[model samples]
Every structure is written in C-alpha cells, then in structure tokens.
Target: MAELAHIIPASTNGPRATEGADLTESERADPTNILVLCPTCHTMIDKGYSQYPAGELRRWKERSRRARAVAFGTPQFTSRAEARAAVEPLLGANRTVFQLYGPLDDVFDDTRADQWGRHVVDTVIPNNRTLLQLLQSNRDLLTDGEKATVDIFAIHMKQLEERHLEGNWTPGSMRFPDAMNVILKGDG
Candidate 1:
C-alpha cells in the first residue's frame, strides 16, 4: 500500500525539531513536503533504517517534479547555471563512487569477488546509464564543448563497462580510476 511520509518528523521535541516551528500545521502538511512511498519504504524512513534529512528529501522532491514536468511537455526553461545547480550534486557524487575502486588483488575470496563483480554489474553500470540518459535528454541545453566532453566520457564509460563484465582486475581495473578522473574533471 502507498503511504504519505513526512520529510521532517512531526515530533517537535528535539533541538533540530525546532526548525518545524516556522511552519503551521497546514504548511507542515504541504504536499511538497510529503512523498508517496510504499509501506516498506515508509516504515524504513519512519524507523530510521534510511536516514533522509529534510534537505535531501526536498532535493528528491524537486528532481521528481522537474522530471515529471519534462515528461509532460512542460519542461522548465532553466539557465545553464540553474540546470547545473540540480545536476552538479549528482555528478559530484560520481566522484565519490570512484573512490571505492581499488586493485582486483584486494578480492581474494571467490565470494568477495562475486560481490564486487555484482556491485560493478548492478550498481555502477546502472548508475552511469542513468547519468548518460540525463545528459542525452538535456543535450540541447548544454554548450558544444560540454556536449563533446560528455560524449567522450560516455565512450570511456562504455569501454570500462566492457572491462567490468570480463571481471579481470588487471589493466582494466587500473584504467577505471583514470576514466573517473577525466569524468570528474571534465564538463558534464
């Protein structure tokens, strides 16, 4: 079942809870401050299994709204800077993900190798795919130089993906960091 979850918890009894005082009950119940989640997700957030702060929840809401607007033929005409404001946070996160990459020798156990391989196959590849989709959809909004840089980055990502599938930890593993460096430094 679907449930409406609060971005900020309702208990006005902690130091941080004081921030909610600025909002009246109606404002606190604003649709923008709520998310429709499945029962499991609702319970996870409410029980602190997933600690989503107010700011992060708000960003998710804004991204969802923008995505819906775009899908519905009502895309917002935001400036490059404004568009970057929303996207840079996501691209910045890509840099951090790369920090987890290391040499293949670290995975000595077969189980650990499987786990690491799954992470590359499942998480990293899909995440990059989403980033690529976002870039492709907004290609017209980007500068020519930005487009060229992302195009090259996409090619690099594709090559890395092939290496990931092979599950070898030699040169392909070494090249992963370099590709990420180019992406982190390159225009998105």
Candidate 2:
C-alpha cells in the first residue's frame, strides 16, 4: 500500500552549498509546525530571489494586518514628559507629523495615520487617558499648566491630521492651533 505524501522543504538533491543538509536530526512529525515548500523553487524562494513565495501568499498578507493594528493605535506614556517626548519627536521640520513604526518597519498608511491622530486627540488625549495616567501614576507630577498645554497640543495635532485628510494642504493650514483659530474666526 502506498502512503499519502505530504509537501515540504526537503534536502537538495543536486550539489548545492547548503551547510546543514541531510545530516540534521529528524524532527518529530508535528503536523502543526510543518511548513510546505516546492522543491524546485526552494532555492529561489529561500534565497529571496523571487517576488512571491510559491504556495502561501496568505501568511504575508496576515503579517501586514497584524502589523497595522500595533502601529495605528494611540501611544501610551508613563509620565507627561514621556507623552510629550513621544509627540515631540513627531513634530517635524515645521510641519506636525507622526511616524508609525511596525514589526517590519513599514511606513504608516496616510489615511490610517489621519484616523489614528484624530483618535488620540479627540478621544484619548482630551479624555485624559494617556496624560492623566501619566500624571497620576507619576504621583500627580504634572502641573495643571503642563496638562493644559499638552491638551492644547493634542487638539492641535488632531486638527492638523483632519485638515490633511480633507486636502487643506496649504502651508500653516494643517497646523492645529492656527486651523482651530481659523475655524473659530470662520476663515476656513
């Protein structure tokens, strides 16, 4: 009787320079941990010579999804200084900007960045989620004025992202305080 064969990465038949070829010990055949690969494409795929992995594109797609969830959330801080530090680094060369860093060092999606910034400003920061936790946990270390300033800064950052998403890309237009003032004065 012929046993059913399963697909996997196997020892290279022809003479290629693999250091740990068939001399390796056998792994306990755990169905859960086995990775399947095509023998002909093994060298090409393993050496990063091809754009696509031959059989499984789903794993690559899954990695991106999980990475986005980690990158697109509001940052938490242990102190007001820490909170400011996180945002301060984001304050770019005259333009307010934030970077989303993920597992693979992927760049932030602009639309997702817009949503994340707004979420932090409108819901998280204003509600004293990140800042208050920082303050209370640090023995009420943040002065009222510092908290107020951060609140204002957070709101400003939110407005900037909102304007950016809405296509108001003129200089100083994406600025948080300036944009808010314009709205208050009915200019934009």
Candidate 3:
C-alpha cells in the first residue's frame, strides 16, 4: 500500500526534524511537498533523513508526477469518432460491471453487495475517472446539451467516489446521465 510522506516534515520534531520556520502553513501542506511511497520506502526515508534530505525528496516527488502525467495524461482528439474510440472501452467495462453486480430493486443481498463493492473499487471508479477525463478533453465535440449532461455526470462521479472511498453516503446523489450513452457519438 502507498502512504503519503511529507518532503518536509509537518512538525519540527517529525521524521526529518527541522523548524520550517520560514515556510507558510499552506506551503507545508502543499501537494508538491508530499510523496506517495510504500511503507518500506517511507520508513527508510524517515529513518535515514540525513541520507535523503528534503531537496532529494522533492526531486523524487517531481519525477513521480512527471512520470504519471506522461503515462496517464488525457489525449485530445480532433473528431468525435476518435473520442468515442478512446472512451468506449472504459464505458463498456463500467457497464458490464454494473449490470453484473450493481444494486437492483429486488435482487440486492449481502453477496451482491460484496461483489458490488469490490467491482466498484477495482473497475468502476477507475473507468469513471478515465471517462470523465476523456469527455472533458473532448468537450469541443459536444453540443450545449451534451455539455450540460457532462456537468451533471461529473457531480455524480464525485458523489459516487465519496460514497465508496470516504464512507460518506449522500442522500439524493445524482444518477448517471442517460446522455452519456451517446456523449461522443453523433447523436449526442
């Protein structure tokens, strides 16, 4: 599992103990000053602060960010067909998972709930995130109505993630938008 480690320790007496007297609260809390490391690496860094200084940790963080951006950055397309091609696989995966394990009016049970939670984390959430990024990147191809639908879908995505990840069940969370079915298709 990954854990967030501060490049500069949050407290003066934290791992890499130093009085960050010159840094503002926001700077200390900034995402740039954080590193997502495995438990082993986190412990190694914390215990060997002299060997891995703040500047070195910041370099590692920047390298990680750049690598992720290169690997997963959203691609912009000039046409709807290209956008659809990019998004279709993720949509189909999400749909198949939902059909197989999603809550139903009278079919939900403990087993189905367990399957649903697993699929939501393993498949649905990632697909939703990628779908949203693709749609947002290809927004130029969408009509005003389609754009509105995308806006609602974004809100629905957030609520869904919050419900699963943070255990914050929000009543009346928006349902998935039907228009998403034809988002990058000519019909939309």
Candidate 4:
C-alpha cells in the first residue's frame, strides 16, 4: 500500500534556505517526490520516483550510458534512519495504498536504508509491464478506479525499468544527497 509521504524527496530545506544555491534538476525535486510505498511494491521504484512516458525511458538509457564513466556501486540512502525516525512516529494516521501481510511496523528497518531501497525496487519491477498488458486486454473487467491505478503503476514501472536499463544502480554509501539528514546527539 502507498504510505503517505513515505517516498518523499531528500530535502527538508524550504525554498529560501537554498536560495541561489546550485541544484540539479533531480536534487531540487527530491524532498517533494518521496511517495508512500507498500512493502511489496517498493522494490521496483527505488532508483527514482518520476514515472516518465515511454519515449523518455528509452532516451534516458542512451544518455545514462554516456554519463557513466567509472565502476560505481549503487547508492545507499545515507539518511535512511533519520528519515524514518522523523516519519514513522508521525504516521499515526497516514493512508495506505495497498494491503500488507503484517503490521507495517514489522516490515520496516529504520536504520538500514539499503535494504529498504532494494525492497522498493523489487516491488515495482516484476510483472509491472505484464500487469499493464493484463489491464489493457481486460479493460472491461476492471472498475474505473482499478483501471486508473493500473495505468499509474504501469507508468511508474516503465520509468523504473528505464532506470534499470540505464544502469541507474547505487551501492551503499555514507553521504548520498538523497540520504536521510541525521542529527546526531551532541553534534549541534
């Protein structure tokens, strides 16, 4: 199920805080884009959140190849724990997009963002396209809302697939921009 504000962007800085600061198109969008994800569906959309049209996913692959220069592991969320710490306690009455096998609390690990990242990718990639096909072929069988969800998920899955094809993988890292902003005790 979609967790409210769970798949959020990587920043908390309001616009004025970063005024005139250099930012990539991606970084600026990080904090705002984080979406609530279900345990089963989180795996697929780990790389990025913006689900683009088909033509873009294909084009991005070509661009990514050129941008990739050295051997680098996938980026792990440096701020995973901090983000979770901040978000979890406040999720007292957030919405869920889908069903879970157990308590939501049981499905998460606040300290380890890497595992969380993987789970997101795994949930969205498999059968994403296949599901689209099923929906298209059986449109008559679906309610209007079901059909809409199918359409949205299909876009997300396709975007993730493109990122995958373009080698948009990351390994564990201590200081990624998208990581949680942990304020260690006694530091401030």
**What does each candidate score in C-alpha RMSD?**
12.6, 17.0, 12.7, 24.5
Give candidate 2's error at residue 172 in angstroms: 9.9
lDDT of 2: 0.40
Task: Give the Cα error of residue 61 in candidate 4, in Å.
Answer: 45
Q: Count clashes in each candidate, considering only residues at least 3 apart in sequence or on different chains.
A: 0, 0, 0, 30
Clashing pairs in 2: none
lDDT ranking, high to low: 3, 1, 2, 4
Q: Which parts of model 3 are misplaced by more than 4 Å?
A: 1-72
Which tens-of-lDDT digit does each residue in 38-149 have in candidate 2? 5654445455523543234336434445455338754343444544444332333123212331112375577766665565455433443443333333434345554454
Model 1 has a clash total of 0
* Best lDDT among the predictions, by candidate number: 3
Task: Score candidate 4 by lDDT.
Answer: 0.38
Question: Candidate 2, which ten residues in sequence have the lowest lDDT sum?
Answer: 179-188
List the lowest-lDDT window of 10 residues for candidate 4.
176-185
- Across residues 74-186, which tens digit of lDDT does each residue of candidate 3 receive? 77666788788888888889889889888888875999889999999889999999988878877988889988988999998999899898899868878788888777787
> Per-prediction TM-score, please?
0.43, 0.25, 0.61, 0.26
